[model samples]
Target chain A: AQSVAQPEDQVNVAEGNPLTVKCTYSVSGNPYLFWYVQYPNRGLQFLLKYITGDNLVKGSYGFEAEFNKSQTSFHLKKPSALVSDSALYFCAVRDHRDDKIIFGKGTRLHILP
Target chain B: GAGVSQSPRYKVAKRGQDVALRCDPISGHVSLFWYQQALGQGPEFLTYFQNEAQLDKSGLPSDRFFAERPEGSVSTLKIQRTQQEDSAVYLCASSSTGTNEKLFFGSGTQLSVL
Candidate 1:
């Protein structure tokens, strides 16, 4: 089974400060990791993914995530937080053995101005 | 269509009533998926279709939940005897391939069962 976990239910950060939303996973094989963001009443939008290459993957809206195989983690990060960065974030994982993508319980990010 | 589109953006159904949700994927997308998202939770995979073939439905909660993507384009999810637990945002997504392609999602249909 492939599973992902978002340890924090909600994260608060001040504007201009760096923010991190933590995520970890469990998979028997190599994991394909992804990050998605969702605003109220809107569908989730893809942020970034890690398949096989670089440890750090940059995504939309100045967001990025680092894939750590040893830690089984793929934490979402931002250099500096903005109020507009507030949204629900999800970590997902899929392995080659299954076509289904499993998502973690979401983390709500709040960037205080 | 420019993106995956779902119909009945909001639905209110009495318990035991049946409802059908519709999804229109982007043109030429080979993979379509249905997911159920409860409040404050991530999207839970319900089913997957490749073209017109229903491949994986292991995530469906019950036999009352049914889905089909005939003709390899538009898809429909039918729920029989709606229950309060079934109230959630049903999302539809599509991708160019069945592999590791990023999914394009719809705004989702919010189903409220009373």
Candidate 2:
């Protein structure tokens, strides 16, 4: 079974400061990792995905994620945070056998002004 | 015209009532998926369909939950004997063939069971 873990329940950062949201996963084989953002009462919007490529993957809204193979981590990062960037972030990993994607609980990101 | 769409943006059902949520995937999309997201939680996979064929449904919470994609275009998720625990936002998404393609999501249908 494949699963994802987002250790933090919530993360707070100031506007214009760098931000990081941690994510880790457990899978049997090569993993397909993804990041998605969900605003209140809205469906999830895709942010980025890491298939097989360079470690750093850039995504929408000036966000990026680093795929660390050894650590089993795909942490989302942003150079500078904005108040509008505050939302719930989710990490997901697709199962190799069935292609069923499992998502982490999610982390609430709050940007302080 | 290009994105996935779901109908009944909000629904309020009394306990034991039945409700149906609809989804229309993008044209020519081969894969469709249904997910349930509780408040403040990530969406969990409820089922998947490849065109008109229902391939996987292991994530569905109970036997009362049912979904179908007849004719390979529009899909519907029906819940019988709705319970309070079933109250959640149901999201529908679709993607083209190939493993690396990103999924396009609909706004979702929020269900409130009383």
Top candidate (DockQ): 1
Q: All models: lDDT?
A: 0.93, 0.92
> Which lDDT tens digits does candidate 1 get at residues A1-113?
88889999999999999999999999999889999999877888999999888999999999999999899999999999999999999999998677888899999999999
Instruction: Provide the lDDT at B108 for model 2.
Output: 95
- Clashing pairs in model 1, backbone N/Cα/C closer than 3 A: none
Residue B94 error, candidate 1, Å = 0.6
Task: Give the winner by lDDT.
Answer: 1
Candidates 1 onward: DockQ, in order: 0.77, 0.66
lDDT at position A41, candidate 1: 71
Output the worst ten-in-a-row residue range by lDDT, candidate 1 chain A.
A94-103
- What TM-score, computed on C-alpha atoms, does each candidate reach? 0.98, 0.95
Interface RMSD of 2: 1.6
Q: How well is each residue in A58-101 modelled by candidate 2, as lDDT tens digits? A: 99999999999899999999999999999999999985556577
- Worst-scoring 10-residue span by lDDT in model 2 chain A: A94-103
